[model samples]
Target: MLVFIDESGDPGFKVSKGSSPAFVLALVAFSDRAVSLEVQAAIDAVSKQLRVFPEFKFSKSRPEIRDAFFDAVLPFDFCIRAIAVQKERIQSGYLRSNKEAFYSFFVKSMLKFDNGLLKDARIVIDGSGERVFKQELSSYLRRHTEKGAIRSVRFSDSRNDRLVQLADMCTGAIARSYRDNRDDADRWRQMIKAKIEDVWDFR
Candidate 1:
């Protein structure tokens, strides 16, 4: 199995200072490596059909492109699990102030709900942070997931990995549902509702 991880919002809890009210981390798991390739190919094809760049980042893509991307890949075999943390409802001062701790906690929280599906899975995460932080995050996930279930934990640039991009898109869709400011918050989400295995909302 192959699993790609990504997050949608910043880990800051300054909601009163224009920070996002909720943060979302998502996991996109493919049961077969072939399916992963198939999904990547589909996304590339869609980008060509729409006459856009082959590399699609959820945050940078327009809503129409995002919708088309999701619609193109939903027919493939994959499962998504996500955790949405509402910053305002969190009561722990330590978690609120420590960005790394908060991020580590939420990532583990989301992975713990995977049941046995993630067994022997190779996990890749967006490698946008500092090298040390990425190493720490990998170790954190390795220590917390089911014993021996995670075969390896590695970091890759989202621009170079289609699976990581897919995870980003999934995270964006889940996070958008919680954004009250967006008029089309749920539009992209409804496209892949069936593929979402679970979405844990941390109040």
Candidate 2:
């Protein structure tokens, strides 16, 4: 199994200090590696068609570009399992005070509930943080998750990793859906509803 992970929102608890109310992590799994190439091609095509410079990001994309992106990759085979948490519901001080811990806990939670899709899977996450934290995250997932659920964990730059970009797009779509302020908040998720395995609202 091959998986790419990305998150749409920051893990900060300051909702009144410009922090996002909800933080989301999206796990995109492809059972067959070759099929991912097809999706990558579709993403590349859309990027070129829309003149999306550098890369595709859900927050930066135009309405038409977002719609076209979801439409372009709809026929592919993949499962999107995600977890979204509202900051107010979280009562743990450790998780709230430490951003990395908050990120790591939720990341492990996302994979722990895998529906038989994870086993010795090579997981890649959007590259962030320094080398030490990256290594710590890898070790943390291994120690916390079900045995053999993670074969390895790697961090990649989203600009170079197309599948990681896909995760970003999907994560963005999901996080947008949770924000009630936007008029078209529901629009993106509805476009890719078929591929979403579940959108768990973590309490």
Residue-pair clashes per prediction, in order, are 1, 0
Alpha-carbon RMSD of each model: 1.4, 0.9
Candidate 1, residues 1-203, lDDT tens digits: the string is 99999998898877778778789999999989999999988977897899876577777889888988888998999999888988888999999899999998998878876766788889898887788988898888888888877888898887788888899989998888987778988877888799998888886
Q: Determine which window of 10 residues in candidate 1 has minimal summed lDDT.
A: 51-60
* Model 2 CA lDDT for position 82: 95
Task: Encode model 2's per-residue lDDT on 95-196: one tens digit a residue.
Answer: 999999999999999998877779889999999998999999999999988998899999999999889999999999999998899999999998888889
Whole-model Cα lDDT of every candidate shown, in order: 0.86, 0.92
Please report the candidate that would top lDDT against the real structure: 2
The CA lDDT at 52 in model 1 is: 70
In model 1, the runs with Cα more than 4 Å from the true position are: none
